[model samples]
Target chain A: MTALLTVDRLSIATQARQLVRNLSFSIAPGERLGLIGESGSGKSLTSLALIGLLPETMAATGSIRLDGTEVIGAGERQLVALRGPAAATIFQEPLTALDPLMRVGRQVGEVVRRRLRHEGLPSSAPAVQTRVLELLSRVALPDPERLARVYPHEMSGGQRQRVAIAMALAWRPKLLVADEPTTALDVTTQAEILALIGQLVREDNMALLFISHDIPVVAGTVDRVAVLRQGELVEAGPVSDVLQAPADPYTRSLVAAARTFDTALGRLF
Target chain B: MNGTAGSMPQTEGKMTRRTIPLSLIVGGVIVGLHLLAGLLTLFWTPYDPTAMVGGRLAGPSLAHWAGTDRLGRDLFTQILIGARIAIEVGSGAVAIGAAIGVTLGILAAFATRTLDDVFAAAFDILIAFPTLLVAMLIVAASQTASLFTAVLAIGIAGSAIIARLTRILAKRVLSMDYIVAARVAGSSWPSIVVVHVLPNIWPTLIVNLALQFGLAAMAESSLSYLGLGAPPPNASWGRLLQEAQGTVYTAPFGAIAPGIALVTLVIGVNLLADGLRAFADPTRRGRR
Candidate 1:
C-alpha cells in the first residue's frame, strides 16, 4: 500500500532551541503508526511541523508530503485548504481543542462548512447541522441531537474528547493526527477513546498518526511503532517486535520503566 | 455522635444561599434614574431650559424648583436637559473609543513584531498625557466645542487606555489553546477575531465601556464648566454650574442643583459598570 502521509528528514527550530531534527516517517492508508517519546522529546513539535501549524517564531526545513502535495512551503491560503479536508488533528486537551463559546454541534458544523466552502462546494446551515449530527453519532455519542446544542464546558472531559474526534472526522480527511488524544482522560475513558480512534481509522480508511508518551497506551492500538528521544528516532519496527525485544538501549529503558511502574502498582493491590 | 450532629447543622448554615450583591442594587438605582430622566425629558422639564424664569439668583421655591441661574433660566430645566447631553456624549464617546481601541488592539496583537512595537509605542505616548488635559488642548485649539467636537476630543483622549487594555487581553487570548485550534482548523484572521477573541473579551470590553462612559460624561461637564464645551444657550449642567458660581452665596440651590445632577449621573454609570462586572463573573454565578 502507498504511504498516504510521508515526512522526509523534517527539522524544526524555535527561537531558543531546536525542536525536531532530521525526522522521517510514513503511514499507509488505514494503518496506525505510533510515535512514542517522553515529555519534551519533540513528538508534538514534529506533529505541528507536519501540519504546518508551527508558530511564526519557529522555522521548519525539509519535506512534508500529504498524499504527494508539499506542505513545507505552502502559503496560508493553501494551508487552509490542506488543514481540515485533507488532514485533521485531535489534540491532547479536548477542552482547549474545542471552542468554549460555540455549541458542540455548531463547532463540528463549522469544520464541514469551512472545508466545503474552501473546496468551492455549496454549504447550507441545515445541511451542515445534519452532517454534524451524523458525525457525532458515528463517534457513538449518546443523544447526539441534544448533546450537539450543549457547549464544550458543559460536557465531561471524555465526552469532549469524543466530540473532538467527531470534529476531526467531519471533514472526512485522508489522514488523522491524534496528539495524546487520551492523555487527560481516565483509564477506562482512555481505553474507550483509543478503541474509538482505532475503529474510526479502519472505518474511514484514513491513515492514523498517534503521538503519545505512554508506550503501553499505543502498544495494542498501532500497527507499527517509532521511538523518539530528544527529536531523534531511536527505533522503528512492528509493534510486537518493539514491545517484545526493543533493540535500542533507550527504547529498552522506556519499556523497562513502564514494566516497573505497572508491577509496582500490581504489588500494592 | 453529638459532635457529628452539631457539625451537620453548622455545615448546613455555612451553605446558606448567597445574597444579591450591593453593587447590583446600586447599579439598578443608577439605571433607573437614567431611564426616568430620559422619560421625563421626552415629555417635559420644570420650565423651558432656555427661557428666563422669575429672576436671576431666585431662591428655591414652588415656582422655580431648584432656583434660577444668573441668566434666569430654571436650574431644574437645565439639569434635565444636561442629562440628555450627558447620555449622548457619554455613549457616543465610548462607542467611538471602543471601536478604535478594539480594532487597533487586535491589529497590534496579530501583526508582525515591528508593527506591534510601533503601535504599542504610539499608544503609550498618547496615554502618557493626561486625558482631560488633552481634551482641553483640543478644545482650545478648535476655539469651538459642539457636541461632535466634544465627543471627538473625549474619544481621542479615551482610546489609548482602551487600546492598551484590549491589546493585553487580545494577546492573552491569542496564546490560548482554542486560538491554536482555530488556526489549525484553518480559520482566517478576521473570522478568528470575530468568532473567537471578540466573544471571549466582550464582557471585559462592556465593563470598560460603561466605566469610560461615566468618565466621558464628567469630562464633558468639566470642559463645559471651563467654557471649552457646548456653546452658550445650550443647557449643559456644567454651563449651569458656571453661570450659578457668582450667585452661589445668594442662591445656593442654583449651583447645588447642577452639581447634584452631575454627581448622580457619574455615580449611576459607575454603579452600573460595577454591577455588570459582578454579573459577568462566572464564579459569582456558580456560587449563587
Candidate 2:
C-alpha cells in the first residue's frame, strides 16, 4: 500500500559536472523496478544515493525517502542504522563485493547476526550459523558446510555471487538494490544468477531495484521498467509496453539493439 | 590420460617443494642460531660477559672460543650478550613502531581530506629527517643515552615510515568494494578496522615490520658506536666493534667476530622479510 522507496527530482552532481538531473521515481513495497541505462547513465549513483552512500566528492540535492527516512542529508549514524534493515545492495563484481580475506560463512553470519539483533531475536553463535547455512542453501549453494569454510577467491564467480546474495538476504531488508549483478558473470552464469535473484525476490516479497544495461535481462527480471539516458528518465512503464512500443527514441534504440542480437541469434540457429 | 594425470600431480608436488623460497630456509636457520645463542646466554655464557676472565688479545681456545677483548673480557661472552641486546632492541622497537604506526595510519586513512593531508604532511616531514639524526635529537633532548632511550627513539623514528605505509595500504583497502559492503551491512568503524582493515593489511605489514626489525637493530648499533647505546658493563656488538677499532692488525678477531654477528643478523632479517613477502602475497602464491 505504501512506497518502499521514493526519489523526488533527484539530482547528483560532481564538482565539475552534473551526473544525474531532475529524476523522479518510487517503488511500492514488494514491487520490482528495472532501471535500464548505459554506462555513466547515473543508475548506480541514484542507487547509492538511496542508501545515503554517495562518494564524498559527489553531491546530491534531491530528497530520497526510504520507508519515510530522508536520506539526502541524513547523518551517518542514521544512514548506517537504516542501510542493512532498509536496503541491501549487491554490487557489479561479486568477487570484490565479498571480503576476500574472510570466509563466506562468516561474512554471511555477520549479517545474519546483525539482522537477528535488529529483530530482537537470540543470536548465539549456533543460531547465527544456522541462519547463515540456511540462507546459503536458499541461494541454491549445495554443501553449505564446506562452502562456508572457503574464501571468496576459492569459489567460482556464480558461487561467489550466491554468497553475496546470501549476505544480502541475511539482512531481510525491505528493498534489495542489485547493480549490474550479473554483468561480470559468464552468459550462462548470468542467466542463472538473474533467475536466482528473481525467484528469491518473489519468494521473499522484497522490493528490488534491478539495475542493468542488458535489456533482455532487465525485462525478464522486473515487473515495471524505467529507461534512463544521460541521467534523465526517458521512459517509464510496464515491461511489455516499453519493449513492444517504446515512445522515446533512446528507449526504442535500446530495445532495437537488444532485438538485433535476438534476431542475429535466430538467424544463426 | 589417467597416467599423465597421476604423474602430473606428482611433478606438481615436487615443484611445490622446490618452490619453498631458499631465503626463508637460510634466514630461518641463521636467525634461529642467533636466537639460540641469545637464549643460551640467559642461562649460561663462557664467563660473566663483562668479567676479565681471559687473557687479552688471546686467539680462539677451548676455554674462550672467540678469545678475549683488550679488556680481557671473553669475546664469546660479549658476542652472546650482544645477541641478547640485538634481539631485545629489534623486538622492542618493532613492537612499539607497529602499535603506534598502525593506530595513526588507520586513523589517517579514516580522516577527512584536510585532516588526512595534515597527517600526510607530518609523516613526510618526519620521514625526511634521517632516522639516526632523529634518534640523536631524541637522545639529546632526553639527556639520557641508555638502551631504553635508544630503542624508544628508534621506534618513534621508524613509526613515521610504518605510519606512511599503513596509511597507503589502509586507503587502498578502504577503496575496495568489500569495505563499502561492510559499511552497508552496518559494520561499525571500529569493527571494520578490527575485522576488515587489519586482516587485509597485516600480512604486508608483518613483512615490512620484519625489515624494520633489522633497521632498528642496526640503528641501535649505530647509536652504540656513537657512544649513545647501552652504557658500559653491557657489551653490545657495536660497542665491541668500536672497542676493536684501534687493535685492528694485532687481534683482528675482536672486530671480525662482532662485525660478522651484526652482518649475519641483518642478512638473516632481510632474507626473512623477502621470504615472508613471497609467502603472504596470494598473487605470488598462484604463480608458484
Candidate 3:
C-alpha cells in the first residue's frame, strides 16, 4: 500500500536549538502508527511540523510528504490547500483546541464550508447545519442540536474533544494525526476518546499517526509503534512485538510503565 | 470535575454578564436624557432656541428658564440643542473611530514581517502623541471648522488609540490555541477574523469604544471652545460655554448650564465605561 505520510530525516530547529532531529517514519494507508515517547521527546513537534502549524520562530528541514505532496517547503497557498484536505490534526488540549468565542456547531461547520467551497457546492445555512449535526453525531456526541448553540467553555472536556474530532474529520482527510489528544482527560474519558478515535480510523481506513507519552494507551489504540527518545527514533516495530519484546532499554521501561498504569487504572475504574 | 473545570471560564463570563451595572444605568440615564433633549427640541422647544425669542441675559424665569444668552436666544432651548449637537458629535466620532480602528487593528494583528513591524512602529509613534493635540492639527489642516469636520478630526485622532488597543487585544486573542486550531482547520484569514478575532476582542473593545465616546465629547467641546468646532447657529455646549464666558460674572447661568451639561454627560459616559470594564471581568464582578 502507498504510504499516506512519509517523513525522511525530518529535523525541526529554532535559531537557538534543535527540537526534533533526523526522525524518519512513514504510515501506510489504513495503518495505525503510534509514536510513543516521553514529554519533550519531539513527538508533538514532529506532528506540528507535518501540519505546518509550527511557530514562525522554528523551521523544519528535510522532507515531509503528506499524501505524496512535498509539504516541507510548500508556500502559504499550497499549504492551505494541503492542510485540511490532505491531513487533519487533533491536538492534546481540547479546552483550548476549540475557539472559545465561536459556537460549537459553527466551528465544525467552518471546516465543512471550506470543503464545500472547494467542490463548487452551495453552502447554505441549512446544508451546513445538517452536515454539522451529522459530523457531531458521527463523533458519538449527544444531542448535537443543543450542543451546537453552546460555546466551547460551556461544554465538558470530552464533549469539546468530540467537537474537535468532528471538525478534524469534516473533510474526510487522508491522514489523521492526533497529538496526545486525550492527555488532558480523566482515565475513563481518555479511554472513550481513544476508542472513538480507533473506531473512526478503522471505519474510514484513514492512516493514523497517534502521538502519546503513555505506552499502553498507544498500545491499546494503534496497530504499530515507533518509540522516540529525545529527538531520535530509538525503536520502530509492530505493537505486539515492541510491547512483548522491546529492543531498546527506553522502550523496555516504557512497556513496564504501561503495565503498571494498566493494573493501577483497572482498579480505579 | 472535568466538565466543571472545562466550563469554569464561561460560567464566570455568564455571571459577569448577568449583573446589570450601576454605571450603565447612570450613564444610560444621562446619555438617554441628552438623546431625549435632542428629540424633544426637534418637535417642541419652549421657544425657537436660536431665535431672539426672549430678552437677552435674562435670569431663570417662567418664560425664559435658565435665562437668555447675549443673542436673546433661550438658554434652556440652547442647552437642549447643545444636547443634540453632543449626541451628533459623540456618536459620529465614535462610529468613525470604531470602524477605522477595528479594521486597522485586525490588519496589523494578522500582517506578517515588514507590514507588522511598520504598523507596530506607527502605533508607537501615534500613542506617544496626545490625541487632542493631533486632533487640533487635523482640524487646522482641514480648515472647515464645522461640526462634521470637527467630529471627523476627533474620530481620526481617536482611531490611533483604538487601533493600538485593538492590535494589542487582537494579538493576544490570535495567539490563543483556538486560533491555531482554526488555522489547522483551514479557515480563511477573513473568516478567522470574523469568527474568531472579532468576538474574542469585542468585550475589551466595547469598553474602550464607550470610553472613546466621553473623550470624543470632550474633544468636540475643546475644539468649539478654541473656535474650531461647530460654526455659528449650531449652539454646541462648548460654543455656549465660550459665548457665556464674557458675561459670566453678570449672567453665570449662561456658563453654568452648558458647563453642568458637559460634565454630566462626560461623567455618565466615564461611569458607564468603567462599569462595563468591571462587568467584562469575572474576578472584578466576584469582588462586588
Candidate 4:
C-alpha cells in the first residue's frame, strides 16, 4: 500500500537562507518515525510545512502528499480541511498550547465536534462533550470530568500537555506529528507523556512522526529515525541500526552529545 | 497557588480572589447615583426640568432646587435630564465604537502582513486627527444638531481609537501559541475570534472601554458646546454649560450646577476605570 505521507524533494527557504533542502521521506500506516536534529536544523520547519503553517516570509517547494492530497501549493481551504481531520499536531509547549481563558472541556470539544462532523457522526454538544471527557480519560488526566470545566491556567504543565494530547487525538488523525512534545516537561512528566503518546499510537493505529532534538528521546519513542543536520537529512534507518551503529559522523556526534549530557547531569547530581 | 490548585476548592476560584478596591466602591456609588437620577427622571423630577418653573438663573430654594436656567426652567430638572443624556450618549457612542472598531481591528489583524502594515499606517493617520475635530466635521456635514447626531458623530470618531486599540490587542493575541493551537484544533475563524481572540484580550478591552466612557462623555459634551449637538430643549450638560457662560457674572449657579455634575461624573467614572484595571490583575493574592 502507498504510504500515508510521502515527501519528495521537499525544500523550505526564506529570503536569507534555505531552511530545509531537498529532503524526502515517507511514513506508512501505524508506523512510528522520529525526526531528530539539533537547534536550527529545520526539524520544526519541516513539521510546520506539513501542517501548512509556515511563516509568511518562508516559501516551500516540492511534493508533500498526505494520503493522496498534495500539501504544497494547495489552496488554504483544502489545507484547512486536511490539517485537523487528516493530521493533528501536539506542539512543544504545554503552557501555551491552550487558550487560557477557555474551559479545557471546550478546547477539546472544539476538535471533537470538528472530527465528528468530518466523520458524519453526531456532532451535538452532548456528544462532543462526552467524547472530550473520554479523550481526557484516555490521556489519563486526573479527574477528567472536573478537569474539563476548569481553565488551562488552573492545570499543571503535565496536565496541560495531557490536555493537548487529548485535543490532538480528538480527530483520531491518521498522522500525529508531536514536535518536541515533551521538551518543556519535567523528566517524570516527560516519561509519562511519552508513554501516553506511545499507547495512543498503538490504540489508534496512528502513523507517528515524532520530532525532537535529544537522541535518547527519539530512540525511546520511535521505531525508525531520520537524522537531520543543518537543514539536510544526513542519515535515516531503523532505530537500532542507526543509533547503535551510526554511519554518519554527524549522527555519531549527536549520539556523543546526548551521552555527554546524560553523564554530565548524572555527575552534577 | 500550585500546591492547592487541582484539589478543587469550589469557592475560591482564581479570579474571585482579588479584594474589591475602595475606588470601585466610591466610584460605583457616584455613577450609581447619576444613573439613579437618570432613571428617576423616567418617573419623576421635582418639576418639569425643561418647563419654565420660576425666575431665570435663580438660586437654590425648597420649591425649585438648584435654582433656574436662562429659560426659567428648573435647574435641578435640567441637571437630571442632562445626566440622562450624558449616560445615553456615552453608552450609545461607546456601543457603536466597540462594535465597529473591534471588527475592523480583528480584520486588520487577520489581514496579510502588507495589508496589516497599511492598516497600521492608516490607524496612525486617523489617530493623529483630533477626535473632537472629527466629530465637529461629521456633525457639520450632517447638519442636524440632535442627541442622536452627536452620538453618531462621536461614535464614528471614537471607532478609530477603538479600532487602533483592538488591532494592537488582537495582533498580540494572534501571535500567541494558544491561538495557533485553536486553529490546529479545527476552530473556524469566527470561533477563534469569539473563543480565543476576544477573551484573551478582554480585561485590557474592558479597561479601554471604561476609559472610553469618560472620553465619549467629553466628546458628546464638546459637540453640544459647539451648537453641533443636542440643539435646544435637550439639556445636555455641555449646552447647559455653554448657556450659563454668558450670564456667569449675574448668576453662577446655572454654570456651577451642571459643571459640578459633569466633573464629578467624569471623575467618578475615570476612577472606576482605574479601580477595574487594578482589580483585574490576575497575579494579586487572595485574602484567605
* Best-performing candidate as measured by DockQ: 4
Q: Assess each model's interface with DockQ, reporting 2 decimals per model.
A: 0.24, 0.38, 0.41, 0.42
Tens-digit lDDT track of model 4 for B84-164: 999999899889889988988999999998998898888888889898998888888888778898898888888888888
The TM-scores that each candidate's chain B achieves against the reference are 0.87, 0.90, 0.88, 0.89
- Which wins on lDDT, candidate 1 or candidate 3? 3
Q: Candidate 1 lDDT (Cα, whole model)? A: 0.82
Cα lDDT, model 3, residue B140: 90
TM-score of the second chain, cand. 4: 0.89
Q: Residues B85-183, candidate 3, lDDT per residue (tens digit)?
A: 887888899999999988898899988868988998898898788988888898899878888889998898899889988999999988887787777
In order of DockQ, best first, we have 4, 3, 2, 1
Candidate 2 on B178-205: residue-level lDDT in tens? 8898888888889889988988988789
Which stretches of model 1 miss by more than 4 angstroms?
A: A119-122, B1-29, B35-44, B274-286
Fnat for each model: 0.32, 0.40, 0.47, 0.32
Give the per-residue lDDT of model 1 (tens digit) for A1-269.
66878889988888798878889988887788999999999999888877788888889899998876788988888887677767788999987887766778888887778877876877988878888888988888877888787667667778888888887887788889999999998787888889889999998888888999999998978999999999889999999999899999999999999999999999999
Give the alpha-carbon lDDT of every model.
0.82, 0.88, 0.86, 0.85
Chain A TM-scores, all candidates?
0.96, 0.98, 0.96, 0.97
Residue pairs in clash, model 3: none
